[model samples]
Target: MSEPVLELTGLTKTYKPGTPGAVQVLRGADLSIAPGQVVALVAPSGAGKSTLLHIAGLLDLADQGRVTICGQDMTGKSDRIRTAVRRRDVGFVYQFHHLLPEFSAAENILLPQLANGVGRSAAQARAMKLLDRVGIANRADHRPAALSGGEQQRVAFCRALANAPRLLLADEPTGNLDPDTSDQVFAAMMELVAGTGLSALIATHNLELAARMDRVLRLENGRLTEITGQQAGAGFLQSD
Candidate 1:
């Protein structure tokens, strides 16, 4: 078997470490994502789901744990190395679109590639290809403000994938949209992921959406566990 695309081992995080009021968010949490797999992370608010993604994406550090991406161990790496790893191997998406209001959708995607040292012509072509994959190529010329909520989110998806990262980390990616739009946008994002053959770890409260992934994980008190149908049903009710 090939190595997994991403792995987290014994991850632990405390917000106020060494302080009297320190709150431990993760208690040796562990998870892994294989190539072409979509794993859904389901956890209640304040359950430290965001923290896990940040650490996995190298946006933040874990107090005690190891993070490996594409078979490379990233724990204790310098900020420069971490940044390079993040830029070259990881892509992140949050609940909000967070697109640049002034830049067109195509430009928003192209800029990151440029920053990664890709040529302008190749970056432009890649951006349009991703836009077309998401069924939003026509809106590529429009700025975020000009697009509908779903369209904007689709563009955001394109931007996140601009560099062809090996791993994708997303937190409540479709949380801001209406039910119909959310489903549509989520489906489009899945299509893009499938087409690219990348591994994705998406945090979502929507059970229906979670069920669509290859596996479901629950993060509670900082430990991660694979959840079954019964647990998923209970979590659905609890989150609702």
Candidate 2:
């Protein structure tokens, strides 16, 4: 079998450790994502789902744990090495679409590929392809400020995948939109993920959207618990 695309073991994180107002967020959290599998991470607010994603994506270090990506151990690695791995193998999306207001949709996507050493023409082609996948090809030349909320988020998704990362880590990719828009944007994101065959771990509060993924896992007490599709709708309730 192919190796997992991402792995986390014994992950633990705390805020203001040893202080009077200290908060322990993660408690030996463990997770693994296989290649081409889309996993939904369901959790309540402040359950440390973002923290876990930060650690897995190499954006933040865990107080104690190991992160393995594409078979390489990231624990104790140098910052330079971690950054290289992150830029080359991982993509991230958050609740808000943080696109550059001045750049066009295609430019936003092309920027990352250009940074990764892709040729200009090649990057532009890939950008168009991604935008097309998300049904936003015609909006490629529009800036973020000129697009609707759904369109902006679709651009962000394309940017995330521009580098062809092996793993995608998203936190509430469609949280800011209304239900109808969220569903539409999410379908586009899933289509992109499926077409690329990359592993994704998406954290979301919407269980209906979560259930559409391959598997659902709830984050409770700073740990992850695999849950059934039937149990997905009740994830937030059970996490409380």
Candidate 3:
């Protein structure tokens, strides 16, 4: 089997450690996402789903554990190395679009490539290609405020993929949209991810969406449990 694009072992996080109101988000949680695999992480609001994603994405730290990205052990690494790894290997999408209101969709996508040292012309071309793949090419020149909810989310998807990262960490990518729009947007996002052979770990409360992925893992009591398609439920996100 191919190596996992992202791996977490013995991950533990505690907020306000040793305090009276300390909350334990993760307790030795372990997960591995194989290359080109799409895994769904289902958890309730307070079940530490966001905390897990943040740690996995290198946006936050774990009190104890290892974070390996594409074969490199990033845990306790220098800030510079961790930043480099995150820039080169991971893309992220959150529940909110968070696109720059003043920038066009294409520009929003292009800026990240530019920051990564891609030339302007090359960045523009790549942005256009991603927009086309997401079926939002026509809206490329529009600003976030001018686009519909679905279109805005599609733009965010393109932006996340702009750098061509090998791993994608999406937290409720379609959560903010209506049911119909969320379904359509998710289909487009999946097509885009598959086309690039990217490994994805997506977190969503929607059981139907979770079942569509290659595997489903539910978080409870600061641990992960493998769950089957039929086992998914609206109440599965509860914390232990």
Candidate 4:
């Protein structure tokens, strides 16, 4: 079999380690995600789900562990190298839209590509195509302030895909949208990822949405466990 797109071994993170207020968030958390896979991460608030995502995405460093993305060992890599890898191979979406108010939807989507030195024409073309794929081509020229929450989120989705990342990380992506809009956005994102065969690890509280993913795992007591097939079908708790 091919190597996993993402791999974490003995990952651990502690805040204020060696200080009086040190708190351990992850205790040897381990996980592996194959290319083109869609995995849902379910955990209660303050359960360290976001912490794990940040570490796995290389946005934050683990106190003790290893992270390999696309077969590249990230351990001991410099901040610059990690940042480059993240910009090139990882995409992130947060609960909030986080789009710049001054930029148009298309421009916002093209920002990352431009930052990576993609030509203006090529980046714009790719951004426009992503916006079209997400069903928001008509709103390309609109700013975040001019769009609805769902539309803004759609724009953010397009921006995340602009880099053609190998791995996508989403934290509570649909937490702020209404049920119907949330479902629609989630479906659209999944469809796009499926089409591109990109791997994704999403942290979400929406059990119904999580149930539809290829696999589901729960973060509890600082460890990751596969959700039972029955529980997956029944859906996880919105609160837990």
Quote the positional error of residue 178 for candidate 2 in Å: 0.6
The TM-score values for the models, in the order shown, are 0.96, 0.97, 0.96, 0.96
Per-residue CA lDDT of model 4 for 151-212, tens digit only, reads: 99988888888989999999999999999999999988998898889999999999888888
lDDT tens digits, residue span 93-189, model 2: 9999999999999999999999999999999999999999999999999999899999999999999999999999999999999999999999999
Tell me, what's the RMSD of every candidate? Answer: 1.4, 1.3, 1.8, 1.4
How accurate locally, in lDDT, is each candidate? 0.92, 0.92, 0.91, 0.91
- What alpha-carbon RMSD in Å does predicted model 4 have with respect to the real structure? 1.4
Clashing pairs in 1: 26-222, 27-222
Off by over 4 Å in 1: 230-237
**Model 4, stretches more than 4 Å misplaced?**
234-239
* Model 4 error, position 89 (Å): 0.2
lDDT of 1 at 58: 90
For residues 1-240, write the lDDT of model 3, one tens digit per residue. 898899999999999999999999899999999999999998767889999999999999999999999999987798899899899899999999999999999999999999999999999999999999988899889999999999999999888999999999999999899999999999999999899999999999777787888999988889988887555555543323
Candidate 3 stretches greater than 4 Å from native: 233-240
Best by lDDT: 2
